[model samples]
Target: MGVVSVKKSVVLLSLGHACVDVYQGAVAALVPFFIAERAYSHAAVAGVVLAASLLSSVAQPLFGAVTDRRALPWLLPVSTIVGGVGIALSGVSGSYAVTLAFVAVSGIGVAAYHPESARVARIASRGSHTAMSWFSLGGNVGFALAPLLVTAVVATGGLRFTPLLVLPALAGSVLCLPVLRGLAASAANGSVAAQAKRPDDRGSFVKLSIAVVGRSITFVGLSTFIAVYAQERVGGGVLAGTIALFTLYVGGAVGTILGGRLANRWDRVTVVRYAYLVAVVAVAGVVFVPGPAFYLFVAATSAGLYVPFSLQVTLGQDYLPSRVGTASGITLGLTITIGGLASPLIGGLADATSLRVALAPLIAMPVLSWLMFRTLPEPAVMGADGSDGRQPAPDVGHRGAVAVGVDAPGQVGDGDARQRS
Candidate 1:
């Protein structure tokens, strides 16, 4: 098959990713509205956030495990629609408990889509990091667009207009049908067969999860508090905060693109380690540096932190090839969410001490993440025929050259020989 064909398939999966994550992004954007329209207390608002994070995190791995045992292509469309509908209903209820339930519904939908979609992306990608990056980029774009989308509709039509948010989910699911069919076709061709022969590495996956946890804490912390930090320092109202948040998100999107290229050039583990190293310094600059100069470091910190995002997902799948769905769930869903669990502690610290003190701890997380990457070994590349699970011969070509396995291309059991070449 042509490279163009493979890329088009990956793009479809990326679109589904974007559609699913839009709800997650909207949840964060919805917080202020809840406080203003419903007069929710800070604790109540925290509860709402917790509802979304907890269900999504806990259910994702379960969904992954289910997909590993059986393909759930239908889940792609179902989950997208469910996620959007849940968010749409959130504003209809004035009761705090009712609102929490609606948010949790959205979280569950978010959880269901990630693992299966990621697994499809992996199979269709044939082991190309650049291709997978496009998938990750879609989710990032959805997240970045959330505030604007939610704010625009709500600002014009009031909080009651929240139902309008569901349109994306509806449209996304309709558009995603063809993508799901493509995934099914890819699996039938040989992706599913390749998986049965591959072994799962539980130990490495656990370590990678830890590394993901560290990165998540720093990232979530920045997203949660950067706007506030900017408002205090920059002396502008919501606009200044919005600008700072935009810088971080846009930086992440750009970093994701660069990470794919860097991984292709220098190898995945090396790129992950160095990115975290840069993250440490950048985060410190964000904390200590004064005035608008700090915004530069915020962008720098976002870039460094996000460079490892998609790489980690692929690494986890490589580490546990037999359970790509489960690995996707853990890496893409569960591990990163562990950061949300720590938000209350950080908030308490901010209450007791200061925002600077709360943020100061994030600088150390990247250092720990860097240390974790040092222990990871390069994963074995799949043979052109993904059926046989064996490492390729060493130094088959020039420096940075990938060694092709002793299997014919486009055969069952040969995943995508494209990576080895």
Candidate 2:
């Protein structure tokens, strides 16, 4: 595909991504409304969040496996519609059980959308992590927009107008149709899968998963408590906390974009390694440093943690080339979900001890994750054939080593980085 064509495809898919994830974000925003309107207990509201998390994060692989088994581009728009509709209907329901059900429905849509979307994005990206970053940035922006959108809807018309929230999803679903057609057309032609021959690097993927778990735990913990941590650390109350939290999340979004650009010039694995190392320093600074310096480290740490986020999804797709959908599901779903699951424990620790002590564990996580990344062997297909198995740069000639195992059949490199014998 041409550059413009690829760009258009990525934009469309990213829109669908944003639309679907907005529901996930909406769930969080909706919790306060539930408290106000339904008088739901803290545990009950948590149940709602838990329901969304379980269905959305856990079932992703199943949806992905199905997509891998067959072409299902249709799921993109269908899931988008379902996701938004679920969220729209959530607040209108009077029964707590019914509300939980609606949120879970939205969560299911979120689950179904991710794997196939990531697969198509990888194809459209043609191996550009920078392009993939744009796709990921869509979801980040969506999550950020959720609160604003939800608040506006509720403030203007109250909970009754919540159904209006479905408009974005409706628009996104319609827009994604053409993008789906483009993806289907590309699949009919020779695809990225056809261009590069790769073995299933399951061993490496498992190691990557371990590393993701570490980052996820640290990320979600910080995300859950950064505002609170800011309030306590700076003694600046809610506004200061809000600003600190915003800085952290915005830094992450910016880092996701920057990492993609860096990947164009250097090895993705190298970029990931350096990002984690930076995270180690930043996280330590967050714990040890006080005052304004703490907020600076929060932003620095967020950037470091997020730089590799999109890269890992692409890497997972490369690792399990034959099961791209499944790879996307795991990398995008379970790892982060499991980390989110750990946040309560982190909170409990904070309850039992000081917030600083609870955060102390976070400082060590990046160091461990950085070491785990060290165990990741660069993908054999990375530079084989002079392409990073992604779309080649416009100026780069397609002259170099053919995919290493194209002619000879054997496994790719293992974690040790030794070439296949």
Candidate 3:
């Protein structure tokens, strides 16, 4: 494959990623509307979030394991449509039970889409960090746009207009075709053979996953209620919540891109640690600070939390080089969605106490993440042929490489690595 083809494939994959993730964002974006239209309590709406998350969390790793065994590029488009359909039908029915069922179905679609998509992205990106960051950015952009998309269709026509939400999924599925074809062509040419298996560092991966769970709880909790919280703090009604959600998501785009560039200079673990430290303060500001400046803190919290997003995915892949699909599943899908499981707890607490009091515990999540990251050593870089790239040293533990750089042996330079059969 040529550089142009690689860039094109990555771009298409990113756009498709955005389309599917729009529903993920839409789930949270729809919360305020669900409250206003249905008169649902905070706990009730949080259950809706659980419906979307609970099944996805369980199924993502299973999907990843499947992808690890064999490629399933077709899942990309099929899952996209399924996810969109589930979300589109969610609001059309008035029954809460039916709504939960549809959302869970959507969660399954999301679960199936991620592992295979992440594998395909790795193939397309040829292991470039910057490229992967761009791919992650697409999902963040989708999240940023979800509020506007939901407000435009559902708010205007109420939940009945949700059918229109499927349009992006349709468009996204179409966008996936060219990339799928590219993968097929590569496979036919024997350039897309099974990657050489490497030793799995289960220990480091476990620690990284724990840190991700902490990050997930913070992000999902904020996304779930930031809009409502914004309304309470700023008195701008739905518009305030929309803006707050938008800021929270859009800032992630900046953070992801920044993370890629920073990785070129600092170790991924180091970058993640500092970012979490910043997140601790920013999340506090969002929960406690008042007035319109709340938007600024929301953006800060987003950037801080997201700087580790793509880096963590790549780190997970490196840590478990032989199980890239499983790594991607956990880093990109399972741990992230698991945060939604806590939404009900937060909601129930809010119902029992004030929203402010309910949100106070979230301030410690990033602190825990920072602590976990402190224990992690970066894994050895895997060569193109699946060989470990680290040179033996007395100080380097059994975990392998303690740091990575653009010029590191076996590392692919930005936009330069391409598969050759």
Highest-scoring model, TM-score:
3
Candidate 3 per-residue lDDT over residues 31-124, each given as its tens digit: 9999999988999999999999999998998887666655567899999999999999999999999999999999999899988787677667
TM-score of each: 0.86, 0.80, 0.91
Residue pairs with backbone atoms closer than 3 Å in model 1 (clashes):
384-414, 385-413, 385-414, 386-413, 386-414, 386-415, 387-413
What value of lDDT does candidate 2 attain over all alpha carbons?
0.69
Instruction: Tell me the spans in candidate 1 whose CA falls farther than 4 Å from its real position.
Output: 1-4, 35-43, 185-198, 385-421
In Å, residue 173's CA in model 2 sits off its true spot by: 1.4
* TM-score, candidate number 3: 0.91
List where candidate 2 sits over 4 angstroms from the true fold. 1-4, 28-48, 93-96, 154-161, 186-196, 228-245, 284-294, 347-360, 382-421
Q: Residue 69 deviation, candidate 3, in Å?
A: 0.5
Q: Report clashes for each candidate as comma-separated counts.
A: 7, 4, 0
Q: lDDT, candidate 3, residue 9?
A: 85
Residue 96, model 3: lDDT of: 97
Q: Candidate 3's error at 308, in angstroms?
A: 0.5
Provide the lDDT at 111 for model 1. 88
Worst 10 residues of 2 by lDDT: 394-403
Candidate that beats the other on TM-score, 1 or 2, i.e. the better one: 1
Give one digit per residue, the lDDT tens place, for model 1 in 115-157.
8777656656766688878888888877777777878887677
